[model samples]
Target chain A: MTTTLRTRQRFAKAGVLTGLVIGGLFAALPVLWMLSTSLKSNGEVFQNPPQLITESFSFDAYAEILGNGAQLRFFLNSYIVAFAVTVLTLLVAILAGYAFSRFTFPGQKTINAVIVSVQAVPPITLVIPYFGLVVALGLYNTYPGLILTHMVFTLPYAIIMITAYLNTLPKELDESVKVDGGTSWTALWRILVPISVPGLIAVGVYTFMISWNEYLFALTLTRTDDMRTVPIGIQLLMGQHSYEWNQMMAMSILGSIPVLVLFLLFQRRFIGGLTAGAVKA
Target chain B: MTSTTAPDTTAPTQEPVTPDRPRTTLTRRLSPFGYLSPTIVLIVVLMVIPIVMVISYSFRDNVIVQENSVFAGLANYTTVLTDPNFLAALKNTAIFITVSTVAHLILGLAFAMMLNTQLLGGVTKAIFRIVYILPWLFTIAVIAVIWRLLLDPSGVVNYVLQTLGLLQEGVNWLSDPGKALWAVTFVNIWSGYPFFMISLLAGLQGIPNDLYEAAAVDGANPVQRFLNVTLPQLRPVIISMAVLDLIWTSQQFALIWMLTGGGPLNVTEVLSTFTYKQAFSEYEFATASAAAVIVLLLTMVLAFFYVRLQKER
Candidate 1:
């Protein structure tokens, strides 16, 4: 009876472990394949029973995009736009968030409701209007134009997230700062700003990911190859006559590297930010 | 209206918190506005204005029959419903939503259960979480392209099957009308389940293991234990994710657009992508907007029920 109990316990542990490891590795298969294909030579990309490791790994695909294609320009455009939007959104959301958390005023409830309701509105509804606005403002194909449009989605997200975080802070902190010689602006900048670094970092990374991954606005608004973002630029590699799978995969892997790195560096905060939706009433 | 006198000529006012003087009226009303000014300005210029424009454009004839602006109340909407493409796209979108949501629920629960096991060490567990999460981080366009390569007639799946003598001929997975919808769905499930897995896993972690042990001692087998113990506990997380997944899948476009573009006789044209093509490609803005408005209404209704059910829980 004792031996049977011990064996059952051992089997249960082993069974569970095997299931997890196998399941996890299978889930990882596509991404692993992507990385592998990104390294393979053009000739080897579609080879039957795709090789896990190529005989001669080549940088030719990477070189093709970097050396010839306007991929670098696209990367730069994406970087500039993502950073600009992130900085602007953080500054604005932090202020709005602070006010929403700390203040009581007429229309406060209405404003909060509006912000939450706006999350349901489809972005496709606004594409045409944004297109017209960009054309009219003479900002078509410009980085600022794209950045401004990207904020349509990111700004509300920032406001909601930052406000939620700020709610956890004590009201006494604000009163205490007021009790000091500091003004509201002084307290906000000197005290509140310094303390909200983690929240800000989380919101900043979230906003950056949205901007970086945005495709429709980037694809439609920017016509020139030089003005393309990474998604649009990588997509253009698939041409009218023939698709360049190797180079396309290479560029995609490059495009994905920054986001992957960002997620790795801030996994906990990033996941927390995503799960923020789960908590809303 | 000359009721109150303006406070005596700029006397250096003592601190209000000193309990000596009354608060200034301007400071009270304008302070919140000062904090919210930037957000309001941005919302008006970017969101509100654009939404208004879409509404107006939807009522115009400039999209379908004419290039210049002309008022055609409900004309675009009328034309959209009559169009063959919109109807087909709508069907495809519905199927995608139904298929993907169910797939995510099942796959996610399985993943969460597997990860909830105790034998895995902290490091190996973390690695597994990251691995599962990597696909969800990718743009839909990239996922579409990568899967396009993999699902081609001579792509990886067929190659493996053929090598193992499992099939006589390679299947044209993407080109066939019958298979294209599932093809897109298969990729969506691959890219989607991670988010669900993470959320469900988080919920699973909070469940005490003693319940499972107690059930086991009661002579419950693994299947019975799961049904008796796991399902009841995971109900809230499952329901919430289901609602979110429903809304999200309804709006998903990039993957379908890139993969099939509502093609092979419009087998997979979901709502969002369909609206995009109709408004932009077909230049039938009115009908497209009407279709979008329908989708919006449906989603909002679903969301209302979801919220109510959640509150009840």
Candidate 2:
């Protein structure tokens, strides 16, 4: 009986270790493939019985992408839109979140319900009307137009997450500020915002990512190539008759770098924000 | 200080009718709205107004060529509902969402369970968690392109399969009509399961070890303990995640658009892509609006139930 129990324990350990290793490799494979392909020459990409690692590393793809003025414009546009959306969304969400968490006011419940329901609406449903609206307002192909539209999705979730995070903070903190002759605005800015830095960072990163990766709105709203974002830029490469696999992969890698760096820097906060936002919602 | 303390205590008792209350009450009534006004204004202009426009557009015969809208009543809806392509898209959406959601749930739960085990060291588990979530962070457009390259006729996936003696010849993954939907579904599952894993992992960590011990003490085996204790604790998370995944997967556009363009004869066309093609490719704005409204209604219904269910919990 002792022998059987020991053997079973050993078997279970081996089973778990094997599962973890295999799952890790499977999860990492696509990203590895992207990095590998980006480093290969065009010839190397089409080699029969494709290799995971190239024999000779090449920087030609990245060099070519860097040389392309159009691609640089796309990157610049993406950065501008993403940054604007992040700043704007954070400002509005923080104020609204503070109000929702700390104050009792008329129409609070109704507004909260609207915010929740807004998140449920499919983004595709509004594309047609948005296209027309942007054109009507003469904001199509402009940064402000895309930034405003991206906020439609980002603001609701940001507010929800910040509110949830604030709910955990002690009300006594705000009361103390009040006791010190500080108004609500001072309480939010001096005490609450400083304490909620992690939550704010999470919200900012989330908003930036959503705007950076947004495809449909970017595709529809921006008719000019110079106004196109990275996702749309990569998509245009796919639309070309001849496939430039290496260049395409390089562009994809470049586009993903900002997000990957952000994640690596704040993996814990991102995961916390995601789960908290989901659970609370 | 003594006088302040006495007033502070009595303030609550006379909160509604103090001599200074009216001004305080007015500020309290107005301040929250002041904080919320910016967000409210933005959502109203960008989201609510657009949706209202979509509803109006759906009722009219609006097209790109005709600048002026003509009242078409339910003609747009009739056209969209009766179109064979739209019907196929609806069916494909259901199939794709069902398959991908189930795959994510099963695989995600399995991964979460593995990550929860003690066999892996802390560093190793952390590294694996990051690896699993890498795909989820990537833009869908990039993911779609990467998979398109990997699943091409002579792509890496086929090459590996051939080397392992699993495939006799390179199969057309994106181009074959019959296989395209499944291919797109596989990509969706690959990119999405991390979400499920993370949420479920959090759920697993929240479950008390005492429950499992109690089950074991009751003569329950490992499998029995999991089913009796683990699964019951995980039910709410699972339902909420499943419903959220259903709404998301049903409206997935970028992956399908980038990979297949809803092509190889539109076999993989879901509602979002269908609406996109109708508006952009065919310039049928009214019909596209109608189709989008239907998709919106479907997701909203699921979301409503999810919210209600969460409230009950």
Candidate 3:
């Protein structure tokens, strides 16, 4: 009986191990396939067997596109816009989070509720008005316009996540800093900011991703190829006459690297951000 | 007594080391404002202004270039309600939300439960967790492109199914009206379930083990214990997750736009795509804005119930 029980346990363990292997392969397939296709020659993509790997790996796609100058401009544009949005969001969200979490003020609750209300509104709802406003402000084809529009989506998210995190921190540190002859501003810069670096980093990544991956506005607002983000640029690659599958796959993989690196670098805090976004307390 | 009194007077010669309170009433009141000012200004410019503009624009008549202001009171709203495209988008959005949310929840719960088993512990499990989460970090563009590749007529999926004799020929997964919506839902669920798994796992970890032991003592079966104990404990987490997923998936545009572009006669068009097509291709900003407003209202309704539920908990 004891032998049978032991054998049964072994069988279960083996089954689980096999399941994990299968799951891991399944999870990795699309990303791996992406990289594989990006390396393959254009003609090999539509083959019946589906070239999982090809002997004639070529950099022609990347080389040809990079030579065109459009891709380079798009990459530079995306970075500038994304970094600007990230920095701006972090600065604003950190201050607001500190205030909402620690301070007593008139209309505080109402302000927080308003922030919550912003999250409920679908971003698509604002696109038309934003188009009108962007044109009115004469920012129709500029970085500031795109950054400002992206902020509408990212700011509320940043505020909510940062505030939730800040509430978890003790208030005694702020009081102590104030008692030590520090002004509120000093307390904010010296005390709160350093302590909240993880949360700030998380918000920065979120904001950057929003700005970087934005499509509808990017596609509509930016007419010049130099102003297009990677998403829009890649979309344009799917033209009327023909679609370049290999080239599009290559661009998609390239476009994904920055955020993937950020996530890997700050996996722990990123998980916290994800949880905060999902399960608001 | 004399020594104590003398020391008290001597100590008073020194000023107090620190002050705990604000120096002035204004400073006291404005401290929070000082911290929140940047955020307040940003939100006002970015969020409030745009939303107000939307509301105002919905009242005007700007089906094309913004030339006229007829102040068509409720006409846009009436048209949006009565339009077949808008209604279809609404129905499709609702269906996508329901199907994706339910599928993710079930699969997520199963994955979490399985991972929580005592045998699947330590470094190996951590590796699995990390692998599972890799998909969530991918951009929507990447997801759309990769799924499009897999769902194409001569894609890897069809190739495998054919080899296995499950399919007689390659299926036009994206272009086919019957399959496009389900294909979108499938991609969404696949992209979403990992996050749910991790969340549910976290929630499960918080549940006490003694309840299971008590149920065992009562001779309750595994399924009975799960239904009676686990389900009730997980109710809040599940509801919150479902609400957030609904909003996120309902607003999904990039993936659908890239894959099918609401193709095969707009059968796959959700609100976001519908709005995009109307405003841009069709050149009807007022009607598009009306459709977007309906999406906001529906999502807000979902969000309201979730918020109230969270408050109750």
Report how far off residue B220 is in candidate 1 (Å).
Answer: 5.0
Clashes of each: 1, 0, 0
Candidate 1 regions off by >4 Å?
Answer: B1-22, B63-68, B164-166, B208-225, B309-313
The DockQ assigned to candidate 3 is 0.46
- What is the C-alpha lDDT profile of model 3 across B1-313, one tens digit per residue? 1211111111111234345433444454566777777777877877778777777667767743757667878888898899898788888888888999999898788777766767767877877778777677777777888888888899888999999999999999888889889898888887878888878888888789999899989999879999988999888999888887888788888888988888767788888998888888888888777777777788888889878888888
- Model 2 residue runs over 4 Å out of place are A1-6, B1-19, B63-65
Q: lDDT of model 2 at residue A16?
A: 88
Candidate numbers sorted by DockQ from highest down: 2, 1, 3
Worst 10 residues of 2 chain B by lDDT: B1-10
Top-scoring candidate (lDDT): 2
DockQ of 2: 0.55
Cα lDDT tens digits, model 1, B1-313, are 0111222112112324333433544454457777888888888888788777777777876643455878888887777778777788777777888889999999888887777777667887787778778788887767877888788787887887888899798988887988988988988988899888988887788779899889988999989988998899888888878887888788787777788777777788777887888767876666766776767777888778676866788
Per-candidate Cα lDDT values, in order, are: 0.78, 0.88, 0.79
TM-score, cand. 3 vs. native: 0.92
After superposing all C-alphas onto the true structure, candidate 3 shows an RMSD in angstroms of 6.0
Error of 2 at A165 (Å): 1.1
Candidate 3: tens digits of C-alpha lDDT, residues A1-281: 99997998888888877876776676778878888888888888878788788877887666656676777787889999899989888877877887787666789989988888777778788788778878888999899999888787788889888888788887666666666766555666788788888888888887888888888788777778778888887777766228677887888777888988887888778777877676674
Residue-by-residue lDDT tens digits, candidate 2, A1-281: 99998898899989988888788888888889988999998878869867867887887889989999999998999999999999999999998998899877778888999998888888789888899899899999999889999998899999999999999998888777767766677778889999999999988898999999998899998998889999999999877737788999999999999998998898899888999888768
